[model samples]
Target chain A: MTQTRLVEVRQNVLKHNDVLARELRIRFQKAGVFVASFVSSPGSGKTAFLEKTLTKLRSQYRITALVGDLATANDAARLARAEVPVKQIVTGTICHLEAQMVSDSLQDWDLNELDCLFIENVGNLVCPSSYDLGEALRVVLMSTTEGEDKPLKYPTIFNTADVAVITKMDLAEAVEFDLKAAHASIQAVRPAMQVFEVSSKTGEGMDKWLEFLQAKFVDGQV
Target chain B: MHELSIALSIVEMGIEESNKRGGAKVDAVHLKLGRLSGVVKDALLFSWEIACQGTTLESSRLEITEIPVVVHCENCKTDRTIAEINNFLCPVCNAPTPEVMQGRELEVTALEIIE
Candidate 1:
């Protein structure tokens, strides 16, 4: 029988992605662009919300986006209607957007020409939490129909995000959504997490969200 | 769903590490897994076998050391172990613990191998 030995391996499993993310962060910082990535469960209004954001902020900032999905570029097509540079990263079976994907997608683009860049991750709460795409802000969306216990059930997602947006608030009343309970649940998992309630259709409560981005672009740290 | 890819990454990392040490056969990998790491242990375990198949880490085991969630309470001025993962409030002052001191680790600490 061969004798066994202990190998000292003090490496993080996701160190490769983390290193790439740090490199991307430096590149984005040098280019003076503020990056924000959106994450949500399927059908949580991420596309609609991003569309509204793109349409609203297109002229103010030289905006561009890279949207990721498991299958089609349908969401990218939808976002293109906003009349900004929008590309789709078809991840196929990948559930989250890694730093390498972001790096590969930005190969031909001039990052300095843009003021802000957004990455819409593949609709997932769990896996996306583990990977960082070099985003200055990570936004998580939860629609009213998804229930108030969502933050409680998927606490890790809430913990990983910088802000949470309650989308489709126009249907809140129709869905009998308890706004108080939802806020309480978000607070329960992530205390003092900035939460926004907005309806992409009606554009209610969007001004504040837009204003928040404006502030970030101006005062955002590299 | 994404656990398979994560498992594959872990296997790849393990293989690279073991190969650096003169192509030793990996016996097991020790990991520091925190509760708030967002990785499902069962799903990861299920995917490990498939990810390791035909790889250098093929029969190797994954040893996970679970780390509990610890939060720093501003009001209490002490780090407290969160009793419930959902309710992130300080038990002493009922104040929201805004700081997470631990429970988000995902590190490969060590490996057992044979020459």
Candidate 2:
């Protein structure tokens, strides 16, 4: 009979992804580019928000985006209308974007020429929480129409996110979106988390969000 | 969902480690899964079975130890295990405990192998 022995491995299951992410972080820092990744559920207006951001920031700074989807390059086509370079990462059946995919898609581009690079993760609140994409900032977006209890329902995403953005604020009143309750929910899960309220369509509250990004970019430079 | 991919990774790791140990057959994989890790235990177990098929770890069992969320409560000046993920307030002082001390672990702590 064979003998069984227990060996202490003590290794993180996602160590491979984590190592790749670390290498990407170092590369981004050396190139002086601020990388921000966006995560949210489907139909949360991620594409619209990114389009608006790219359009507004392209004039002042060189910006680009890499959008991920399960099967379609539609988001890439939409973002291209912003007149900035865009790449689409079709994950096929994969629900979330991994660091290796990001690293692979970026082989052709020079990171030094870009001021900011946004990775719009495949619309998912759960799976994306576990993978780190070597981004300087991880922004979690929740549209006002999604309801106030989103943070409570998906606490892990909120906890891992560096900042939160409440999009589609222009329709807040129509949806009867409780702003106070939303703030309370976000605070309960992630205390002192910086939040921005903006409507990508009407451009309301966009200036403040842009200013915050500008501040972060400046900080990254130093 | 993403657990299948994660399970595949675990199996790959197990095979690699076993190969390094003179191709010993693995009996079980010991994992520490945290509450805030965002992976469902049932889903991961289901995926593990499928991921292990046709591999060296085909018959290996996955033993998971669920870890609870622990946060540092500033008001109490100690670590507290919060019961609910929605409410992150300290049960003792009712203060917001934003600093999490533990519960994000998705690590393979050990492996049971037969020589």
Q: What is the lDDT of residue A111 in candidate 1?
A: 97
- The CAPRI class of candidate 2 is high
Local lDDT at B67 for model 1: 88
RMSD of each: 1.2, 1.1
- Give the Å error, residue B107, model 1: 0.7
- For every prediction, compared with the true complex, DockQ reads 0.83, 0.87
| Clashing residue pairs for model 1 | none
lDDT of each: 0.91, 0.94
**lDDT of each residue in A1-222, candidate 1, tens digit only:** 887777777777788889999999999999999999999999999999999999999988999999999899899999999999999999988888899999999999999899999999999988999998898999999999999889999999898899999999999999999999999999999999999999999999999999998999889664
What are the per-residue Cα lDDT tens digits for candidate 2 across A1-222? Answer: 899999999999999999999999999999999999999999999999999999989999889899999998999999999999999999999999999999999999998888889999999999999999999899999999999999999999999999999999999999999999999999999988999999999999999999999999988741
- Give per-model TM-scores: 0.97, 0.98
Q: Model 1: runs farther than 4 Å from truth? A: none
CA displacement after TM-score superposition, residue B65 of candidate 2 (Å) = 0.6
lDDT string, candidate 2, B70-90, tens digits: 999999999999998888999
Query: Which ten residues in a row are the worst by lDDT in model 1 chain B?
Result: B16-25
